[model samples]
Target: MIVIVDYGAGNLTSVQRAVSYLGYESLITNEPEKIVNAERIIFPGVGAAGSAMEEMKARGIDDALEKAFKSGIPMLGICVGCQIIMDGSEENDAVCLGLIKGTARAFPSGMKEENGILLKVPHMGWNGLNVVQPHPLFNGVGKEDEFYFVHSYFPEPLDRNNVFGVTEYGVEFVSAVGLKNLFATQFHLEKSGKPGLLILKNFCIWEP
Candidate 1:
């Protein structure tokens, strides 16, 4: 069975429902033992970085996540779930799992705004994605397809090779990533409808 890490974050029911739409068996759990035994893991989150990390750490979800990732289980992190994989996030001033060598920082202010004002904070809604490289997680998705995004910060990988896909706001940011067996995306596939289900299904069938 697939496991959705539940440390009190993200749209758990929507994610579970999306998994069901793909005809997969999944359970949302925070227990370490249950996570360890799961065939695949989905880490989803919708909230601020510091509080989310605190919640995970308070419940020992951080340690459990570390173990699950090291075990090489197929894991997918969405939004805040994706941010925690990096070394740190500027918004929180707190450290993260450091699974990947990168940092997530706030959106840059639009140049046209003389006061260095942001184009928009919490960049919500749909945007197109460009497949920077082939990734198992995006098996059935496409470059022309638009995915739902509702995030204020985006990851900037030090090593360009780590970025699997790119998306633009007022600036370009890494939208998809692959670090070894771990995969993550800034988009909400659960809310993407049919295309989203295809991505989830691909992740389930992907051997890695």
Candidate 2:
């Protein structure tokens, strides 16, 4: 069964619904045993990185997640979940899970696009990805398809090899990362449309 980590920081219900919509058995729980034993793990998150890290640590969810991933279970992290998987985040001076060697940084204020038009923070709405590498998660998904995003911070992997996709707002940023058994996206696949659903479906069947 798939386990969705319920660390009090995620959009767990929507993730669960998305997995269910794809005909997969998923459970949303904060229990360590369930997470450690899950066939796959969905680590979905939103909200501030500092607060989310606090909750994960207080409830031992951090240890649970690390254990699960180390066991070779395929895992996916979304949004804030993706951020926390990095080494640190600029949000609230938060130290993240450090599962990936990277930092999450906020989009600078007073930003402008190539045309000098002001770019918005939060980086919401749909944006297309420039797929940089091949991975099982991108199976049957188009590189040009737009995915929904709702965040101000984006991950910057210390090792560029970890970056799988890039997207641009005021500037280009890492949109996706993959390493070993872990895969993560800054976008919200649950909120995205068909192309997004294809990602979820791919995850449900992904072996790596």
Candidate 3:
């Protein structure tokens, strides 16, 4: 069974629906045992990193997630869930899960394009991905495939080797990252269309 961490910060229903649509069973819970024992884990989140961390810690889910990762269970984090996996986040001056060595940086202020068009703060729209390194999760995914993104901050992996894909808004940022049993994306796969579903399917079949 796939366990979707319900830390009160994610779109649990939509994520569960997406997994179910792909013909897999999933459980959304903050229970540590259920999460640690699941065949796979989907850590999907939206909202501020600070509050999310608080919720995770309050329920002892943070330790459970670390334990789950150490146990070699394949796991995926989406959006803010992805951000918290890093060392820290600019959002709330938060110290995150540190599952990966990185920092989540907010998009710069006074951001403008080469053509002098002012860009929006929260990049809320479809964006194309530039695959940096080949990985099984992106096996059938095309470089031209677009995923829906809604975030002002993006992860910057301390080790560039962990970056699997990059996307650009005002600048190029780490949009997807993978290390051993862990995989994460800045985009919301549940909100994305065909290409997104394809990614979910790939995750279900991935061995590690």
Candidate 4:
């Protein structure tokens, strides 16, 4: 069974709903045992990183996730879920899961477009990805496909090879990353429509 982790960060239902639409069974829970035992895991969240990590630790979900990752389970992380998989987050200066060697940094101020329009924080809305490395999660995904994004911070993996995709807002930022059995995206695949669904489908069947 696939487990959609719930650490009180919200966004669990939407992820579960999307996975169900793809004809896969999933459970949304904060139960550590369930998470560790899940065949596949989806860690999706929308909220502050410090609070989320606090909840995970309070419920022992942090250890569960680490154990699951080491067991070679295929895992996917979305949004804040993606961010906290790294070493730390500038959001509340919270230390993270360390699944990937990186830090989640806030977007710099004074962002601007080529036309001189000041870009906004939270970088909300649709953006296209520039795939930098080949990965099965992006199988059949095309250049024209745009994904939904809603964030002020983006991940910066310490190892460039861990980056799979990049997207531009005001500056180019790492939008997707993976390492061994785990993969993550700064964009919300659940909200990205068909292209997003395709990635979900790929993850459901992904071997690594």
Every candidate's CA RMSD: 2.4, 1.0, 0.8, 0.6
**lDDT tens string, model 1, 17-109?**
999878899998888788877889999889888888888888888888788888898989888888888889987786888888889888876
Candidates in order have lDDT scores of: 0.83, 0.90, 0.93, 0.95
Best by TM-score: 4
Runs with alpha carbons beyond 4 Å of true place in candidate 3? none
List, in order, the clash count of every candidate structure: 0, 0, 0, 0
Worst 10 residues of 4 by lDDT: 8-17
TM agreement with the true structure for every prediction: 0.93, 0.97, 0.98, 0.99
Top model by lDDT, which number?
A: 4
lDDT of 4 at 103: 97
Backbone clash pairs for candidate 2 read: none
Which runs in model 2 stand beyond 4 Å of their true positions? none
Model 2 clash tally, residue pairs: 0
Candidate 4 wrong stretches, greater than 4 Å: none
* Model 1 alpha-carbon drift over 4 Å, by segment: 111-118
- Per-residue CA lDDT of model 2 for 1-208, tens digit only, reads 9999988885899989988888988888989888889999999988999999999999888998888778899999999988999989999999888899989998988989888899888898999999999888898887579999999999999999999999988788999998899999999999998988999899889997
Tens digits of per-residue lDDT, candidate 4, 101-147, equal 99999999999999999999989999999999999999999999999
Q: In candidate 3, which residue pairs clash?
A: none
What TM-score would candidate 3 get against the native? 0.98
Ranking by lDDT: 4, 3, 2, 1
Candidate 3 per-residue C-alpha lDDT over 1-208 given as tens digits, one digit per residue, 9 for 90 to 100? 9999999895999999999999999988999989989999999988999999999999999999999999999999999988999999999999999999989999998788889999998999999999989988898898678999999999999999999999988788899998899999999999999899888999999998
